[model samples]
Target: MARRPLVVIGSGLAGLTCAWASDPQGCILLTAGVLTDGAASMWAQGGIAAALSPDDSTALHAEDTWRAGAFAGDRAVIDRITGVAPEVVRLLVELEVPFDRAPDGSIDLALEGGHSRSRVAHAGDHSGAAVTTAMARAVRAAPHVEVREHHTVTRLLADASGAVCGVEVRRRDGSLEVIETDRVVLATGGMGGLWAHTTNPTTALGQGVALAARVGARTDDLHLVQFHPTALDVAADPMPLLTEALRGAGAKLVSDGARFVDELQPRDVVAAAVWEQLTEGRTVRLDARGINRVATRFPAVAELTAASGLDLTRDLLPVRPALHYSMGGVTVDDTGRSSVPGLWAVGEVSRTGLHGANRLASNSLLEAVVTGRAAAADAITWTGVWRGSVRPADPATVRTRTCTAAPAASRPLPLAQVRETLDSACGVLRDGPTLQAAVDCLEPHVGDDAAYVAWLIARSALAHPLSVGAHRRTDNVLPEGVSA
Candidate 1:
C-alpha cells in the first residue's frame, strides 16, 4: 500500500488549525507566501468573539450574531458555534497565546461594533497577530506537520469518479506539480483584495473561490462584501485599518466637529454614513483625541498611530470605507464538508451560513477555529473508511508545446482607472446603469488576474436585487417583508 498524504492549502488560521487538528502524522501544508505575510488574520486587531464574560451567555452572543447577519443566518449553525466558542478560546490560551489580562488575573475583554456586550478577547489591538504567531510557532514545533512555502495552487484535480483526489500547484519557478492526496482542504481567505481599495493583502485574489467555482462547487451569497468604515486614508495605497475597538472605546465618527452618525452602529451603517459624507463634500474623520487618556489600554493602536506620524491627542485621522470581509464562497455544512466529496473548506473561504449576509464583529476568528477543528475531525473519519483504496496518481509525461515567437508583455491596468471605476460604480451606491457600465469598462481586462476578481465582484453584486447588510444600493432600499 502507498502512503496517503492529506494536503492543506493556504497558511492562514483556518488552514493551520486544520493541519494541527487533523494530526495526520505526515500531512503537508502548502502556501503561496510567508505563513503570516498575506493573511488578513494578521491584520485583525479587534480580537476574537466568544462568550467568555460571566455576564454574557452563548444565547446573547447567538442573538447578536443572528441580528448582524441580517436574520438570514442558520440558527443551528449559530448555536453550535456560540456553544463551542469558550472551548475554542481555551485552546488558544493553551497554545500559549498572550491574551490581555486584568489586574485581578481575569481575561480582559473589549467591545466592538454590533455587539451588545463586552465579550471580545484580545491582546490589545494585535490580537490576530499574536494568535497567528503563537499558532505558527506551535505548528513549526510539531514533528508531524510540514510547511511548504512559495507554492500556489492553480487547480484542484478530481479522479474519474468526480471526487477531489489532489491539487495541481504552480511552484515559485513556474513549474507545476500534482500532489496526490485522499483529502484536500481550502483555507483561503476572502475576496477583499479583489477591489482597488481594500485592507486585505494583495495575495487575496479569490483564487480559491474561482478554483472551486470552476470545479462546479455550489457558491452562495457572493453578492455580499463587507466594507470596514475606518481604513486610514494616508499615503498607503490599500490603506491601513483602524480597528473598530477604538469606536467601541468611545471614539466618535465626526465631520467638522459634529457627530454625524452613531459610533456603535454595525459596519455597513458606518461605512454608508462615511460614503454619504464624502459625497456631500465633507471629509470624514474618526475622532480618537478624547480617548487619548485610554491610549495605554491599546498599545498596538497607539504604536501604529505614532509610527504613522499621527498624534492621538491632536490629530483626527481621516478615514474611508475599504473592502474588509466576504460573506460568500463555496457552500459548506456545519462540519466543513463541501458539496464535493473528499474536499472541505473552512475559514473565510467557506460560506457555512454562520455569517449569513454579513459577519458580526470579531466572529471571524472564532468561526475559523471551530470549523477548522471540525473539518479535521471529519477528514480523520473519512480517511478511516477510504484510505485503503486510495492510490497516488501516476505522473503523466508529455512534451511541452512551444510558441514560434514571443508575444509582447501586456501593460498592467492603470491605478487611476481601477480606483475610479470601483469608486464611481461599485462604491456604496449601485444601480443597473452603473453596474452595467462597470462591467463594460472592466470587460477587456477580464482575463487579467485583478480583472477577474473585479468581474466576480460585479457579477455577484448584480445577482442579488435587494441590498442587505454590507451591500447597499442607491436604487434599492431594504425590503419591508424581510425581518431583521
Candidate 2:
C-alpha cells in the first residue's frame, strides 16, 4: 500500500511556504478557494520584517518585537523567530520574490510602526502578494506536491488514539472527500471576519481555531487581536487597507486637521488614538501627501485609494481602525506542533508566542515563513516515523454537518448578528459588561464555527480585566481620550 501524504490546510503565505518547503517529502495542499485568491497574505502591503541593515541586529529586532507586544511575548520564541528572519528573506529571494531594491542594488528596507530600524523588505507595496505569489508559483511547479484547490478542510480526522490521521474536505461541488494523512498543518489564518469591519477576507472566520479547539488543541490569547489604525474608510465591504508603510514613509495621522498622536508608535497605541478620535466624532485621516514618490513606491495602496476616489498625493485619506491581525491562536511550539500528535499550525492560526499581546508591524510575514518552514521540517521527520511504523487506522468518522452549521436551536443568531455582537463588544477598547453581553449572545450558537470563535474572543476579553497590549479594557485606567 502506498503511504499517505502529509495534508496541509490553507493556501496563505504559511501554507504556501510549508508546501513549497516540503520538497522531496511531498504533501497535499488544500484551500477553500483558488490559491492565494482570498487569503489575507495577498492583501498584505507592509512587507516582511528582517534586520538586514547595517545598524540593525537580530537582537534589536527581537527587542523591538517584544516591546511592541508589550513585553508579554516569550523572549526565547521572539529571539528564535527574529534570528531566522533575514535568512527567511533570503529564501524568498531565492524563490524569486521581487523585493524592491535601492540604487546600490541592495534590498531596500522600510521602517514601520514599532520597529527601531529600517527592516521591512517589500516589493513595492504589495509585499505579501509578491512573496506568496512567488511561493505559489514554486508550489505549482513542484513535482512532489499536489495542489487541491477549492477544497475546504471542514474537520481534522483523528483516530481513536486522538492522533490526526486524515481530513474531511468539502470540494467546490459541495461533495465531501476524505484524504488519509498522518501529519496535518492548519495555516487557516486569523478570525478577523468575526468582526463586521475587518481587513481579512470574509472567509477567514477562524475555522482553524474552531477545528483545533474541537480536537482538544490548546489555544492561547484568543482575545488579543490587533486592529489596524488606517483601514481606508470607504463604503466597501471588507475595508481596503492603507498600508502602514505610508506612515513609515512620512505620512501623518491627522484629525481636525492636526496631528494628534505620533504615527510611528506601536499599532495598539495608534489605533487607540484613531478610535478615540472616531468616537469623539472627529474625522481621522492619513495624510500621505508629504511622502515623496508615494505612487511609485506604494502602487498597490495608490490603486486602492484611487478606487475610493482618494489620492495619496492629493487627499487626506479617511481612516478608521478595523480588525486586522490576531495575536492569539492555537498554542504551538517553535516547530509549530500543537498539543495533539500529528497536528501542526502555522501562520496567524498558530500562536508561537512571537506576538504576545500584540504583533509588531511587518513581523507577521516573517513569522509566517519561519513557523511554516519549521513545521515543514518537523512534519517531514514525523512523516518518516509514521510511515515506518504506524498502520492506517480504521476509516475515521467524518462530521456530515457544515463546519458553520449552528446547533439545533429556535432562531439561532445569524452570522451577521454574531459579527455585530463582536464588533460592538470587541473593538480598539473593551469593557466587562459589553463583553459579557456579547458572550451571552453568542453562547446559543456555539455549534456554528464563527459564533464559537466569537464566543471565545468575547469570553477571553471578559476574563482578562486588565489592559494589556491590544486587549485593552476600557475599565482599566488608561490615558484620558484613549480609554474614552
Candidate 3:
C-alpha cells in the first residue's frame, strides 16, 4: 500500500514555512482562506528578532527573551530558538524578502521593547507581509508542494487507540471532507480574537487549541495572553495594531500630554500601566513626533491612522491595551512533536516554551519560522509505523489536561457576548470572582469552541492565583520578593 502524505493545516508563516521545508513529496498545505488572506502572520509589523549585529549575540537575545517572559521561559529552549535566529534571517533574505538595509548595505535592525540591542530585521513596518509573500510565491511555484486554499480543518481524526489518522476540514461551500494522513501539522495562530479588544484578525478563533485538546493532547499556559499596549483606540471591532517598532523609533506613551511609563518595557508591564491609567479615567496616546519620516517608515500604521482622521507623525494617536499574542497553546517538544503520535503543532498554536509567560517583541515571528522548519524536518519522514498509542503529555504543570470531548457542533452564541465575557473575566486584569463569573457564563456552552476556549482561559487565569506575567489577579497578592 502507498504511504499517505503529510497534512499541514492553517497556512501562516509556520504552515507555509513547514511546507517549504518538508520533503515536498510528503507535504500538503491547507489554508482557511485564499493564501496569505486569513493569516495573522502577514499582518505582523515589527520584524524578526535575531542576533546578527556585531554589537549583539545569541546569548544576549536569549537573555532578553527570558527576562521579558518573567524568567518562566525554559533556558534550553530559549537558547535553541535564539541560536537559530540568525540562520532564519539569512533564509528569509535568500527567499527574496526585502529587508530594510542600512547605508552601508547591511540588514537594518531596530530596537524593540525588552531588547538591549538593535537587532530586529524589517522591511519598513510590514516585515511579516514581506517575508510571507516571498514564501507564498515560492510555495505557489514549487512542483512538489500542493497548495489548497478555502479549506478549514475543523477537527482531527484519530483512530480507536487515540492516534491521529486524518483531519476533517470544512470547505468554503460549508461541506465536510476528510483527508487521511499520519502526520498533521497545525499552524492555526493564536486566541487573541477570543477577547473583545484584540489586535489579531477576527478569524483567529483558537481552533488549534480546541482541535488538539479534543483528542487528548495536553495544552499549556492557556491563560498567558499578551496585551499590546498601543492598539489604535477607535471604534473598530478588531482594533488595528500600532506595532512596537513605533516605540523603538522613539514614540512615547503619554497620558494628558505627559510621558507615563517607559515606552520600551516588556508588553505586560506597559499594558498593566495603561490599564491602571484607563481605570483612573485617563487617555493614553502614542506620540510619534520625534521619529523622522514616520509616515514613510510605517505606511500601514499611517494608513490606519489616516482612516481615523489622525496623522501618525503629527497627532497624538489615542491608544489602549488590546489582546495581542498568546504565550500558551498545545504543548510540543523541540521538533513540534505533540504527545499524540501522528499530530504536530507549530507557531502561536504550540507552546514551545520559547515565549514562556510573555513573548519578546519580534520574537514571535522568529519562533514561527524556527519552529516551522523544525516541525517540517522531523515530520517529513513519517511512514505511519506507529506500534503504540501516544499519551497526552503536558509537563509544564502537573494539573494540565485535555479537552473533555470533541467541540460541540452547536453554533456559538453571538460574537459580542463571547468577547464581553472574555474581556470582563480574562482581559488585562482579573480576579477570582470575575474569572469564576466568566467560567460560569461560558460553562453552559458545552459544544461551543469560543465558549470552551473562553472558559479554559478563565479557569487557567483563576488557577494561577498570584500575578505573573500577563496574568494579573486582583484578589491574590504575591510575596514582596516575587517578581511579576
Which candidate has the highest TM-score of all? 3
* TM-score (all chains, Cα) for each model: 0.89, 0.93, 0.94
Model 3 clash pairs are 408-447
Better of 1 and 2 by lDDT: 2
TM-score of 3: 0.94
* 2 against 3, candidate with superior lDDT: 2
For model 1, residues 196-267, the per-residue Cα lDDT tens digits are 788888678777776665444556777677889998887775678889999998898888778889988878
Q: Which stretches of candidate 1 lie over 4 Å from their true place?
A: 24-26, 383-423, 440-449, 477-484
Query: Which one wins on lDDT?
Result: 2
- Candidates in order: C-alpha RMSD to true structure: 5.7, 5.0, 3.3
What digit string (tens of lDDT, one per residue) describes model 3 on residues 169-272? 89999999999987899999998888899999998889888888777687878999999999999999789899999999899999988887998999999999
